[model samples]
Target: MMNILLLYISPGKTTEKISKALSDRFEADGHRVTRLNIGKPGSRTFKEVGSSIFYDMDLIGIGNPVFHLRVMHPLTEFLDQALPYAKPRFGAFLYLTYGGISSGRALLDLSNQLKKNNIPILGGFKVWAPHFYNRVEYPDIEARKTIDEFYSRIKESGYQPLEDEKTKRLFSYQTRKVNIAYHLANVIGNLRELPIQFDQDKCRGCNRCVNECPVGALTMQKIPVRDTSKCVYCYHCAAVCPHGAVICPTEKVADMVRTNKKLIGVENPQNAVYL
Candidate 1:
C-alpha cells in the first residue's frame, strides 16, 4: 500500500466518485490516501502580482502553452508554502481531468512542480465527463467501469503516461505571444460571479458537503449555507450533494471559446484550444 495523493479537477460527480473510489480501494489495501481536488478554489482565489502584464499574459495565453505558466505562477507559490503531508513517501500523483480549450494545463504545471519536488507521477487519466456545465453523458455503467479501471491501476508497477498528440501541440507553449492572446480572450469572458444554488427540497442536511469541502465553505444546518467569499467554486459541494441540489448558476466558461474555428480538431472537450 502506497501513500497516494490523487489530485483531480472534477467539475461533476463522476470524477469525484472516481477519486473517492480510488481512495477507498487504496485504504482497503492498507494504503493511506490523501485526495486533493484542485478544481476547487483555495482560500485566496486570485493572487496579486501587481502587474497588468500578468493578467494580460494569462488571458492572452489562457489554454495555450504559455497560459499554464501564468496560472502556475501563483499556484507554485502556494505549493512552496503549503504542500500537503510532504513528509510522507508520496508514491503516486495522479491527475484526473477533463479536456477543453483551457484543458488541464494547470494539472500539467502541477505535475511538473511535484516532479521537481521529487514526487513520482504514476500517470494521469483523462476521462470524458460532461462538457463543462452540461449533464454527464451515459451515467451508470460507464462511470462505474471508469472508476474501476482507475483504481486497478494503483496496483500496477509502471503505468504508461497517456498523451494525445494534438493536445500536446495545442497546449504546448510554442509561441509566447499567441499563447497570451488566447488566454486573454478567455479571462475577459470568464470573469463573472458564480453564485452557488441549493435546492432546499433536495438537501437532507447530511453535512457530507461540509465535511468533504477542502475549504470550510459549508456549515451544518437543515441545509448547508455556503461561505461564498470562502468558496473556491471547485464544484465539489455540488458534485457530492447526495440530493443533487447544489448548482453553479453561471455561464459555462467554454461558451466563450466555443465559436473558435480552430478548435475543431480537439476531439475531447478537455483538449479544446480556446483561441
Candidate 2:
C-alpha cells in the first residue's frame, strides 16, 4: 500500500469534504492516507508544516478552494513555507473546489508551481460545491461521481497530468468575465475593517467564534470583535457560530453567488469543469 499525504486548506469546508472523500477512497483501497488541514489554528508553524510534507510519501494530494480565481491564501502560504522541505521527485495531484467561475487559473497555477519545485504532476480535478455566499446544494451526485472517477483514474494510471482540452473549452470568455468581477468584489470586500458583522442581540458571547477562528482574528471581550487585519477572510468565524451571529459581506457575497449561479447554474456535472 502507498503512503499518501492529503493536504488542503478548506475554510468553508467544501474542499474539506472532498478531501475526506478522497481519503476514504484511498484508505479503503488499502493505501495509507494522512489528511491535514493547513488552515486550522497552529497548523502552519515551520516545524509542524515540515513534519507533514518532509517525509517521502508515495503520493501527495494538494487541494484547496479557489478564491478569486486563485488558490486560497492560507494554502498558498503553507506551500510557500513548506515546499522547500518537501522531498523532490514525489508524485503530487492537485484538486480544487470552486463556486463555478472557471476554476480559472488556479489549477494551472498550482501545477506549474509544483513542477517548478520538482513535484511531478499526477493529474488534477476541479469539482463544484455550494457557493460560500448562499445556501446551495453541494457534493451532489455529479460531484461525487467526479471525485470517484478522479481517484479511479489515478489508481489505474499512476501519476499523469489530466488532459487540458476539455478544461480549456469549459473556461470560456463569459466565465473569465465573471471571474474578473469576483476578483474585484473580493478586493472591495477586504477593504472593510470588519468584513463580517456580528449581530449584537443574537450574540451570546459564547466564544465559539473566537475559538473557531483559524487566524485568531476574533476576540470575545464583551462580544465577538474581529480584527480584520489578522483575518484572512476565510469566513470560518461565520461558519462555526452556533447563534448565526456572524454576518459576512452580504451584498458582495450575494452578488458573487448570484453571478456564479446565473453563469454556471446549480448541480455538479453542469457546474464542474474538470482538467
Candidate 3:
C-alpha cells in the first residue's frame, strides 16, 4: 500500500471537509493515509510538519481555501520547507475549495513550485463552495465524481508532469477568463489583509477568534482586536465565532462576486477535475 499525506490549511472548514473525503477514499482503496490540519491556531509549525511526516510519504495532497485566488501561509511555508526533501515517485495533487470568484493562480503557483522539485503532478480538483456567509451546497454529486476521478489518476502506475497550459488551466474556466481578478487578488495578498470587523458588544469576551486564527492575528482583551498586518484573510475567526460578533464585509465581497459571476456567466455552481 502506498503511504499518503494530506496536509491542508482550511480556514473555513470547506477545504477540511474535502480533504477528509479524499482521505477516506484513499483509505478505502487500501492506501495508508495521514491527514493534517495545519490551518488551526497552535497547530504544528511548518518546519516541524515537514521534518518528520513528509519523509515517508509517497504521495502528498495539499488542500486550501482559495482566497483572492491564492494560497496563504502555513500551507505556503509548509510546502517551502518540504521542497528540499522531495524525491522521485513522491507524487502530489491539489484540491481547492473556492468561493467561486476565481480559483486564481493558486493551482498554477503551487504546481510550478512542486514541479521545480521534480514531484509528479498527478491531478488537480476544484470545487465550488458557498460564497462567504451565504449558504451554498458543496461536494454535490458532480463534485463527488471529480474526487473519484482524481484518485483514478493516482492509481495509474506512472505519473506525468502537466504541460504549462494544462497546469494553469486548473485555475478553472472561470478563473482563466478573469485575468484582471488575479491581478487584483495579488494586490490583496501582498497586504496580508481581511475585510472584517468585530463588535465589542456582541463579542462576549470570547477568545475563539484569537485562538483559531491561523496566523495569530487576533488577540482578545475582553474582546477581539485584529492585527491586519498579520491577517491572511482566511476568515476562520468569523466562521468559529458563535455570536454574530465578527462582522465581515459580506455585502462588499458579495457584490464583487456577483459582478465576477456575471462576467463568467455562472448560473449554477460547478466542480471539475483537471488532469
| Leading candidate by lDDT | 3
Q: What number of backbone clashes does candidate 1 have, counting pairs of residues 3 or more apart or in separate chains?
A: 22
TM-score of 3: 0.83
Q: Candidate 3 on 170-251: residue-level lDDT in tens?
A: 5445654557766654554444343688887898876877877877788888678888777776667777889989987656
lDDT of 1: 0.47
Model 2 weakest 10-residue run by lDDT: 266-275
User: Candidate 1's residue-wise lDDT over 108-219, tens digit each?
Assistant: 5655555566544444443444543566553346545654665576346343333334324433433453365456545543443356777788888887787766556688
Stretches of candidate 1 off by over 4 Å are: 1-11, 20-90, 131-133, 137-185, 195-214, 218-229, 234-275
RMSD in angstroms, candidate 2?
A: 4.1
Error of model 1, residue 238, in angstroms: 6.1
Model 2, 1-275: lDDT tens digits are 88888888777788888898889888898988888887666675555656545586778889878766677666776787777666634477888887644566677678767756776676677787675555666667877888888877766775555444543343332565556655654554444224578898899999877766655677787778777666776676777788988887656666655665565544334343243
Q: Which segments of model 3 are wrong by more than 4 Å? A: 48-50, 157-178, 184-195, 263-269
Instruction: List the candidates' TM-scores in order.
Output: 0.50, 0.80, 0.83
Whole-model alpha-carbon lDDT for candidate 2: 0.69
Displacement of residue 78 (Cα, Å) in model 1 is 7.9
